[model samples]
Target: MQQYNPDFDYKSAAEEVLAIEIAGLKQLSQHFDTHFVQACQTILNTTGKVVVMGMGKSGHIGKKIAATLASTGTSSFFVHPGEAAHGDLGMIDSNDVVLAISNSGESGEILGLFPVLKRQQVTIISMTGNPSSNMGKLADLHLCIKVPKEACPIELAPTASTTATLVMGDALAMALMRARGFSAEDFALSHPGGALGRKLLLKISDIMHSGTQLPKVTADAPLTEALLEMSEKGLGMTAIVDADNAVIGIFTDGDLRRLLSKRVDIHDTTIGEVMGPNPQVAHSNMLAVDGLNQMQERSISALLIVDDGQLVGALNMHDMLRAGVM
Candidate 1:
């Protein structure tokens, strides 16, 4: 093994490579001719799913492209060309679009499956470095992903080609996403475990405390009773509601401290006498992330979720935080 250098500056070398790859991707803006639009329109018109196929490093990029397309509203899956020969070709359909990725557009593994794929009547979208190669010529649509040079010092590795391929994949997915009018809610449906899902899919009713768990007091109730409700519910505040259970005011920990500091008698004062009226509230159907934004905007810690002006539930900042909506 070669001797390790204590001052190799690996981080700087990596940054230089990334910078070169980024510059290479910037150059691809010139390659987006009418053919790019045609490719997008063809994929969009296909009633069947998109099938991605590639080999080696190209295969890795193809898999990610498939996943991104799926998440962004285009249904797609990656099928290794090698695996297609071993019976996975059944995944393809006559109406589907096939995207074949190969740096040289002459990958034997991919070319090996072209005849059969063509028989299935699938439209072949080829992405390659050499547009004149056999795979590129045979494709119904060809996307050039050429690079000036590899970022590697020896010009042998695949840094620039891979970056160009990845950028092209992103462009395609984003194009399809916009063409389909895919919304954040649609994206959340596919990424239900991600932050966007928490923002778009989780509702106020799903996480708010309801029934006996809700820290609430009648408008006529004594301040001592309100304090007890807040303590029992473990929320930092209590909601003061009218006879119809409509939230009319709020009393928080800060209010309690102020009342105590002024030597106000909790036993003598009613919740209506000290509560802050016309407090901010939300509907149970509102997104939890929206509720969080509202709370942050109002500089308050809790929110009361009401339906038809009736308090259905309540939640505090800690609850939203615990739910990962904060």
Candidate 2:
């Protein structure tokens, strides 16, 4: 029977595992050389996708590697080696590059697809701990992910080696990202459903309230009228525009509170008398993130969008939050 100890040093064991994995990653870094460069060149030159394949634990890591590569501008997908041997080999084309993973470089399922890949004229890049093994020998290029030891206490499970392999895959993906000049905008394009996509791809014009939705009161309008526009628009603010529809000032809830504190008559005062002059403004094309930064830096909650020196639209902190640009 297996023994259980309630006093086991769980924290120490976890720390030891982390230390071993860190050491393995450091060792893996030392193997980056001409082979790494050649692998990158081969993937970059391929006209088709990078088909990643592996078995067991390596297959799990291969799926993640393929995902990272795909998101970072390297077109790629993961294919289980076992499935590939049974008619899934049709997914690979002569123009595609294959990235196969195996710690021993001799996984039977992966090895079985070698002749088919070779016959299809597909370029093969192998990642393994043993460069002398069959998969490495048959590959057009080989990447070494050898580690000094496994983090598992029994030295049988794949722990440190898998960590090192993941780090190597990340390195390759980032190298390809840099070489392809993949910008944050490009990344946002690939991830359009997330907050990052909103931050990078959303512009001021896309979310700012304009035209009939805009809260506006001429600079000569009475403070009561401005307050009415603010309440009707529900933006907590109103733009004080001049005869040419240019924003000369802005009247917000903060200004109204200050005006009330001064015992001023809302019915008697014009918006120009109580409005904030030269309020912070944004251009229609400005990124919503930049607009948010401007609002944060100035300690203000609202911004007027201007185009060619004319008030075009307006939005406040609440709008930014609602649009997911906050």
Best by TM-score: 2
lDDT (tens digit, per residue) of candidate 1 on 59-114: 99999999999999998999999889999998898999999999989999999988
The C-alpha TM-scores of every prediction are: 0.94, 0.96
Candidate 2 ranges beyond 4 A from true positions: none
The prediction achieving the highest lDDT against the true structure is 2
Give all candidates' CA lDDT scores.
0.92, 0.93
TM-score of 1: 0.94
In model 2, pairs of residues that clash are: none
User: Model 2 misses residue 278 by how many Å?
Assistant: 1.8
What is residue 184's positional error in candidate 2, in angstroms?
1.2
lDDT of 2 by residue, 28-103 (tens): 8777989999999889888999999988889999999999999999999999888887888999999999999999
Clashes of 1: 0
